[model samples]
Target: MTGHRARRLTAALFATSGYLATIPTANWLTTRYPAAPVAPGVLAPAGVYVVGLTLVMRDVSRELAGRTPVAVAMAGGVALSYWTANETVATASAAAYVLSESLDFAAYEWLRNHGFTIALAISNAVGLIADSILFLSLAFGSLHYLPGQVIGKAWMTGAAVVLLLLRRRAHHSGQLRAPGFSGATPKAVGRPMRRDGGGHDGFGDRAGTPTHPQQNETASEAMP
Candidate 1:
């Protein structure tokens, strides 16, 4: 019933829905152009996954006060899988996804803990490049039917831009603020509060003022 609890629930629901949507969206896109060139058709699913992952991870990063590098890596992996239609390519894509995403997660965590924003930015950029290379090499390295490598590279670049921009908007909007810890709360300092129980303030506090001690205590205990 509380504002914070509602925000958390909403965030959780959004994440779950977005994750579930990935499968169907990818499948639909892949099937739409079953006979077309893989590169072009693949872009559909890849674009969707990129947009969804960016929005989801933006909120996650804001809530956690850090970036979710695994999400970005997963975006690359998913794009690769959808692009590659072969069984062997699929397997390789899975492995690449797992490994790259794991590494990205670790790298992001390290950078965050060390207060290295620049390092985090650089690492994320490099990771994106590495993921794209590994994915393309595994999925389409042998294929000559697809257009020049530049096409795929361009797709990757575009996806990265979309993700970064989404992240920036989410951060600026304070959509990533954890439940119960918003501008309306006494503990919140810089962020502005929203009237409808969303935004930086989350839901309206029961008292219609800053959060009370009990609310703060509850929120603190829930921190991960």
Candidate 2:
């Protein structure tokens, strides 16, 4: 493979690996530590912080690896959770992971055309809320941890979004090359491409410059 393509593949694999690892890591954390208090009277899983990072990584995995592979990774995560966590935590995690991820996937896909940052923020918000409610209810048989869960996940999501926005801004400002869903490094935003597919060379062709004969042909006439 070309060096660029190989690099892209490597990045995708790394993102997928991170996504797969987060679930089991969170499960193990819950198994190892006592519940942490998030509010005066509320207690959330000690793994809440790691699970928050998992949501952000999930979206990144989808961007890099595409949908089907991410689905398989989700299954792998569920299996790992079952092995690493208590039966109740595993069951609750599985249910919440499947349902909340589905909601996140759907919302992200629908809003993706709007903008990456906007879609990510909204989808993560939806997923976080659904995950907190379902997992807390199923695992503890109550919503006592809901507030803590939401607050923790929101902090992670907001921080992740901010970092990504800064990265994109750097790319747009010609300070970096951003990897995006297109599998190509993005060109600096607002810079036009030439007809020959190179960076813009000049403001415009000389006023009387001869144009390619093909350029003068109408679109319908040029078709084979």
Candidate 3:
């Protein structure tokens, strides 16, 4: 297979693996301990799952050279997370994870396709709004005795915004250009050279006369 195809296959496998791993990790965390701060068992695994999935999606996007599929994959992740959990909190958390992740993917793609500085700013802002609403609502919305959802949402949103900003600043800027050629501009194959020593111009001429001086000189000289 060609190199691009190979890379795309590899990326798809990696993304699938990461996505599968995230489901159990998120479930395990929220279920094992039904309390605040959850536990290291839950939080650590969930955190790792989120980060890993994010990385995988990013890599896949890079490999595919597009953002739409990546966005769709992220949306799938959220749906999967929602389905995996049995409890309300767990379900909420899973749902939150999905929303937050999908938003992140969208933002990331937008920034990638657009200018880094502006894209980063716009995506981060939008991501913060989405993450805050989804995460806080899921994490604290069901808890009766807890403070207002807005309070939690605000804090989470602020933290997420900071993190996104830092991440954007730290990472190298620019979107990944897509691989493979389209029908409109397929990659050129072997080019033909003129017998007359003219440079190749990409067109092959099977019937063109020899243009070389030696061939022509002999023909003309011999002709009297």
Task: Pick the lDDT winner.
Answer: 2
Looking at model 1, residue 203 earns an lDDT score of 19
lDDT by residue for model 2 over 1-224, one digit each (tens)?
Answer: 87745765787798788988889888787777648865577677888878888888888777667888788888998899888988888888889999988999889888765556677789988888887888888888888778888887777788888887776555443422333212232322233322431122111111333334333222113211
Score candidate 3 by TM-score against the native.
Answer: 0.42
Per-residue lDDT for 1-224 in model 3, tens only?
97745755665666555655554455554455333332232222233224333433343343344445555555565556555655664566556556655665577555543333334345444544454355445665633323332233334434544564455333212111224323234232222223332211111123333344344333223221
- Using TM-score as the yardstick, the better of models 1 and 3 is 1
Q: Estimate each model's TM-score.
A: 0.44, 0.75, 0.42
RMSD of each: 10.0, 10.3, 16.3
Residue 80 local lDDT, model 1: 52
How well does model 1 score by local distance difference test? 0.43
Best candidate according to TM-score: 2
lDDT (0 to 1) per candidate: 0.43, 0.70, 0.42
Clashes of 3: 2
For residues 31-57, write the lDDT of model 1, one tens digit per residue: 343223325344322322332343234
TM-score order of candidates, top first: 2, 1, 3
